[model samples]
Target chain A: MALVLQTVDLQKRFGGIVATNDVSLSIEKGARHALIGPNGAGKTTVINLLTGVLRPTGGRILLEGEDITDLEAHKRVHLGIARTFQINQLFPDLTPLETIGLAVSERLGMGGQWWRLVGSKSAVVEQAVEVLDRFHLADVMHERTATLPYGKQRLVEIALAIACRPNVLLLDEPAAGVPEAERHDILAAVAALPKDVTVLLIEHDMDLVFSFADRISVLVNGELFVEGAPEDVARDPRVKAVYLGEEADA
Target chain B: MMAAEESGDASRTLVAQANAALAARARWSPLEIAFWLAAAASIFLFPTKHLILTEIAILGLFALSLDLLLGYAGIVSLGHAAFFGFGAYAAGLLAKYHVVNEPVLALLASGIATMLLGFVTSFLVLRGSDLTRLMVTLGVALVLREIANRLEITGGADGLQGIVMDPILGRFSFDIYGHVAYVYSLIMLFALFLVARRIVNSPFGLSLRSLKGNPLRAAAIGIHVNGRLVAIYTIAAGYAGIAGALLTQTTQFASLSVLDFERSADVLLILIIGGTGYLYGGLIGAVLFKLMQDWLANLTPQYWQFWIGLILVIIVLVGRDRITRTTDPIRALVQRATDRVWSGVRGSG
Candidate 1:
């Protein structure tokens, strides 16, 4: 299998504390890869490093063979890499329609045009509508995003990423804070994404993770602790011990 | 399965309605049209008030420039008068030296010149928090004022002198009755207003609002945050410069006071009093501000400003959220009507 994203000994440190250790990770093309770790395993930190939100202290990130370690966050997005925040970073005052339209327009290279209204471009609006429909956000398409239910807000976050048509989409806790009723929609929407675009999900929900991921990479203290098929990882004694130990500690 | 199919169809209908509704909202409404109509009528309707009306027009344009930066982009600038003063001086020197004889051309030249200054200085304001930005912008204005005060060409504290504006379009001479000046200012205001309207409603403007709401998220969606900021700041500077040029072209003079602190403060006040975000806020604010100043001066010449300051405090204390809550329904109603009408047309077509 071809690797779509690979990191060679990526490292980050805050003073003396290591946030992301010398952890080399790879995501194969068309792979539904899930990155799982307990609290403070640096899962979010890894996502941030990959997306250029935080500069890595050492090593390199390769996206389809190109070194992207030095790229800016926005530039990284343009280079076929997109991400959703763990805490749902969104434009509160903007409607879901406008939000998706902006993402579509930005990708279509109309973001810089001050002379053209958002509705002036049929392609942008149509693509935006399609994104809203796919994520089941059409019902609340015109409402202020801040006023949305947490579940819908999470859905909008992922919809925005999908609108960019990225080659690799990183979802950080897509089901986090979503209601029990809305959880099914989020998981189904994620599973129904197009096959060509690889997904790397950072999640805490084992049910969703085991159900969705073909490959599971468990992280522990900013390092890769285990990697295998979901069933293999699930049955592995070491992986089971890690969780049981954490349970005992808690 | 049937329920799912029905919901899918419902989603399609909603999205389709959204497409039509979006187009309708972007179109000009009757209230906006009436507002402009009244602005145009004022020149003829209040012929004797042309002088004050001219000032209102200039002030309105200046406030519009600020609205782009503060309201749309969320870039708080305490020294926006820098461009206005620079434009005023540029036009004054052009007219004084007979370098550019035509007023409109000279206005364009002044605007372009100040745009260059704004572009260069844009970087200074780019890498900062709000407090840092405030200091840097204020510093730029103060430095410009000092330079204008020191320069021989600017006539030092006396300001640039001997400015002569030829008739607009080479025919209409500026009259003492403030006839041509008011017409010229009004026309300039409307022309720029339309351009600003187009910009704020555009995709780029949407991106700007996104930046204002969340810069980190805007960047995540592939928006170059700093790049967007620099672009808006430069455009706003050009607009302010054009407004300044209008003042120089009409009054036939430019002075040190044009670049002073009060100019910046007053424009900020105008924007705050009227509200921001929408382009009309600046124009409406200018009218209210200028009229209030006029009437208040007539009634309480010594303490007019005291009352103005008190009104601003009252507005702030009473809160913008409370104010908008009361008026939002009217806006929502209009938007809903526009959508219905637009969908009706689309359905027929």
Candidate 2:
């Protein structure tokens, strides 16, 4: 498969702290990839570097073979790289429908049209509704996103990212803080995403990572410690010693 | 296959309802229609009240401009009067020097000048959080006020006087009765309000609301945050400039008070009274504020400030949401009715 995104020797340092150190990654087209590690392993820093939220101290980022290391966050989103926050970052007053509608309209380049009502753009609103329905948020589609349950807000955040019609999506802990009962809903929604879009999921939940990721990359101490098919990574002794530990043997 | 058809029908119903809700928000509600009609009818109902009415109209426009920044874009500014004073001085200088005697043309010139100022200072305002923005904006206004005070052409603190405006459109003179001035300011208010209304209902407005809600997410979703702020700030400055020009043109004078810090604080208070985010807030707030000021001044001319301050204190104590709570009954009725219709349609489907 063609590589959709790649980072070469990505490094970020804050003072004496090495947040992301000499990390290199490749995401292939339509790949179900997971980046897993223990706490403080620099998974989110890597995601931020990829999404242009934080500039890499030294590295190169390429999207579809074009260098995008110097691009702004919005510019990267415009280039079809979209991401969701580990903690839900949503407009408190806007409904899920309006939030997603704004994303869709923005993606379509109709966000600057001041003469027409947003509702008048039927195609954009329909697409937003479809995306929301896919996340099973159709019932509370018009309710304020901040008032929704934490899991549902997580779904809305992902829905917003997907509304951009991105070529590559980076989901940072989609199930974090979600109740155990609602974790399955998030998993199912993510699993049902179309395979034409490449996905990079950074998650701590091993069950979700094992079940959803076709290929897994384990990060230990801000470096890529191992990469393989899910079963192979599960069986790898080094990954076990560093991340999975005794759980891998079980 | 049957289940699929049912679900499709249900989804369609939901979409229709969503579209209807969006449409409802986009247009003027019945309350807004009533407000406009009452305002229009007041010209005849209170023929002697033109002077105060003109003041209300101009001040309303000023408050509306601030609302666009503070309410919609979430940019809190304490020096919005810089644009207002710039417009007033620009118009006054033009008329005093015979640069432009045409009222409409002078207003336009003043608006553009102040808009340029807004564009330049917007970078400064956008650089920091609310506190930094407040200090920066306040600093800008104070600096401009000192410049106007020390300048010769600005009348050196006495203000630019003898601003002789020609007949508006070569027709209606600004008579002592203030009929023409009242109508002129009212027309400008209605026209600009339409523009603001159109903007807030559009996609640009939605994007602004999104930014105000969460700038990080807005940027993550492809909104050029700083660019949007700069554009709206410039546009709002132009609106405020026009309001100041109206005051200068009608009153035939531009004074240092135009740039006073009180002007900025007063407009901010006006918006708080009316509630922000919506365009009508400024207009309604102006009406209530001016009428209360008139009544209180008559009752206690020397201590009216005390009463106005008290009212503001009450508003803050009660919370801004309480101002809108009185209208909740109507909003709830409409929402409940819509919900029933949607549920009914879904159940049948």
Worst 10 residues of 2 chain B by lDDT: B24-33
Q: Note the residue pairs that clash in candidate 1.
A: none
Q: What tens digits encode model 2's per-residue C-alpha lDDT throughout B1-349?
A: 9999998998788788789778767655556677788888888899899999999999999999999998999999888899999999999999999898889999999999999999999999887899999999899999999999999999978999877889988988899999989989999999899999999889999899999989989999999889899989999999999999999998999999999999989899999999899887898899999999999999999999999999999999999877568778977886666567665767999
lDDT of 1 by residue, B113-144 (tens): 99999999999998879999989999999999
User: Where does the lowest 10-residue lDDT sum fall in candidate 1 chain B?
Assistant: B16-25
In terms of lDDT, the poorest run of 10 residues in model 2 chain A is A241-250
Name the lDDT value of residue B186 in candidate 1: 89
Q: Which stretches of model 1 miss by more than 4 angstroms?
A: A236-238, B1-15, B333-349
Complex DockQ, candidate 2: 0.76
